[model samples]
Target: MRQLLAPALLVAGLLLSGCAGFQPLYAQPGVTRDLGAIEVTAPAGRTGYLMRQHLDDAFAKNHSVAPRYTMDLALAEARYPRGVRIDNVATRYEYVLTVTYVLKDLPSGAVARRGRVRVELTYDSADQPYASISAQQDAQDRATDEAARRIELELAAWLGTTAKVAAK
Candidate 1:
């Protein structure tokens, strides 16, 4: 039984390894360059500011080079109270951020892609006012980071596939 189990496990491992062709998206040819060439334009507000900063970091935009693509972003944020106390005070809150974006080719001025991403987070409302404010700010930061990551992934995937198609 031991000999049979070892052989079966080895075979399974080899088969599974062959099935996986996983490759990092940014590592693909042209994908990283394309990401670095994108410029983001976000709406006016704190949430928009956060999203723009996060997106710039994720895209690794280069200041020296002119952007090849422009991404226009519209952001909306909403907060809802949850876990209400007996006195009608809220013990927890949910933060929801929704972003809609359009990617356009700079020279051609043509829309390349359009997508939306939503991020939701929950935070506890502390008794202290400052602590509660701090917690809410932290939640907003986390949500913005998450939204930026999602946008990066979506753009990378699109760029990777488009590069492949263009190559062929």
Candidate 2:
């Protein structure tokens, strides 16, 4: 029992140490701070500007593996594809948000990554005009943000992988 006790204690200590410094093993080794510039383009007007803000923040936050040099969002034109007809039709005013982001390599003048994310929100008619329409809008915005976040997260992962491979 005494012989086994020291080994068990060592194992326990190692595990506890891991908990303190536990970074995901999938993170590529010796690959940090790529600092590559990225450009994000959206549509025109306030909605487009807001979407650009969302894209810029999401890109920076999600690009964990690679450090971004600079990020830009240009307001362009937006043409939304028709949304699918929702059933039940409980919502009075339908809300939809579409986001498109393009990442470019600054010095190289090449497109590195491009992605689009769209979210449609529906609210019950009965819930509106109860002095809570703003609440509904907030909820819809939250949902849209989540959707854009998820899409950006996936895109960043792919970008990181590509950048790492390309660097090598």
Candidate 3:
């Protein structure tokens, strides 16, 4: 009975300690509001357009109110042939999309945060031209969506920590 009780108490103590100082990042006050206030500017092209759409959705921007911060993104895209056949024809391709972003405070015109997010995707190359193009477009969409998600997470974390620091 003593041995069993000791292990149970240890487990309970460990569980209680784990919850002592744990705070959910997104639950911090004003994180969602801060995110919604950012305006995103992306380059001009299909990839840029897709990225902008994703970011706008993620931020839930409200155009009626003035923005507190602006984010500028520089996007680069590249594609490489991954697998080649005996006759030097490509069978698979790799697509890489990278975006470097700078977040600036609109009020003070100072840079608040800078980050880069990159995503790589692979798609099979088809003999039909239309099919190949469709596959590449699908990859581009996926890469842009993933990059947007990562950027949103990073920005939320940064905003959360900044709020904490300011509070202290």
Candidate 4:
């Protein structure tokens, strides 16, 4: 029984291994290397600073290597009063951040990818000056974090696909 079970298991394993060519997107070779080689350029401001920081961390970029791609970013922001009090003052506010990015291949000077990512967050508007500012700042931080995450995902997927195509 043991000898038969060993042979059956070996056969099943071999068949399964040969049956599919499925591979995870991130598992592809050169994806991480390409991501780390991207250079990020964002506008100057608090929101832009936040976005750049988040993206750098997400990419785990290595500065020592020469960049293969340059990413240019355009950012737009808006704020609106959501819940209004009876006195016509905003009790809650919604902050919106929209970011458009263009990735250029440095060597070829051609566009590799174009994409946009948006994030929205809400915060309470406190009567106290410092408290209100703090709330708004918190919202901005959260929104940038989310936008950076989305951009990272899109770029990674694109890089993986590009690598696969090049490989073939």
Candidate 5:
């Protein structure tokens, strides 16, 4: 049984290896460099600041360098009460963050790409006031991080494919 299992596993691995069209985005030649060349505009308010910080880290943008592309972002947030108690209290809440972004080519001022991302998170509301506030803050942080990650991935994939096409 063991001998047969080993051969079967080997065959499966070999078959899967033959499939194409799967490549790491960052491993592509110019993707990382392109991401680093972008400048993200500073956003407004506390939540916006968190989102912008995450994006800056993801893009690896250097403070000293002039950006080749400028990215402008707009953020909106909403909260909804859920799992309501009988006494007109809510036990849980849902937080939603929506971010829209535009990427522009610096030299020509042409809009290169535009997209939006939405993230949702849920958290329990504690009995204590401070605890409830803390929980809500944590949810916001999680949602902001997720939104930033999605935006980074979208931008990287766009840069990878567009760079390849432009090079051709």
Candidate 6:
């Protein structure tokens, strides 16, 4: 029985450590985007579907393959983006997306990623009282576009950090 207990402990340790070595090609082990492809989901009564969509788009753009569980990505949704802003009045919205994530060997066993990225597009038509509605909207669109890029860049940084850790 004593010998059996020693072997059992060793096996358990190895199994647990295996998670550390199971690094994904993109992100960390449990911190992966999606296995093959990813799925997206948002909270009840929230409209951050775009958050998941952005991730999907990003993943597809990077890998040229659909995420494994794209339909189920809602389970992994993190942040949300407010809609297109047209004026300085600032139509305010919030996106809260968070999922429990485990990285290869992250501290606290969680990712600061919080799965929450803020996409705020500010249009200051108020600053230019002479600005036309069309101009404001156009500027806002550009802002939104920039915001999307910002989010993608942020996600890339997050993934990059994870990869850097893995190389160590």
- TM-score for each predicted model, relative to the true structure: 0.89, 0.51, 0.88, 0.86, 0.89, 0.34
List the candidate numbers ranked by lDDT, top first: 3, 1, 4, 5, 2, 6
lDDT of 2: 0.53
Can you write out model 3's per-residue Cα lDDT over 28-65, one digit (the tens) per residue? 88788888899999999999999999998888887877
Q: Which of the two candidates, 2 or 5, achieves a greater lDDT against the reference?
A: 5
| Candidate 2, backbone clash total | 1
Instruction: Evaluate model 4: give its lDDT.
Output: 0.92
Q: What is residue 150's positional error in candidate 5, in angstroms?
A: 0.6
Which pairs clash in the backbone of model 3?
none
lDDT digits (tens) for residues 72-96 of candidate 2: 3332222222333466434344556
On residues 91-156, what C-alpha lDDT tens digit does candidate 4 reach at each position?
A: 999999999999999989799899999888899999999999999999999999999999999999
List the global CA lDDT of all models.
0.93, 0.53, 0.93, 0.92, 0.88, 0.43
TM-score of 1: 0.89
TM-score of structure candidate 2 = 0.51
Q: For candidate 5, what is the TM-score?
A: 0.89
Candidate 6 lDDT: 0.43
| Ranking of candidates on TM-score, top first | 5, 1, 3, 4, 2, 6
Off by over 4 Å in 4: 1-22
Q: Residue 74, candidate 3: how far off, in angstroms?
A: 0.4
Residue-wise C-alpha lDDT for candidate 1, range 48-162, written one tens digit per residue: 8999999999998888889999999988889999999999999999999999999999999899999999999899999999999999999988999999999999999999999
Better of 4 and 6 by TM-score: 4
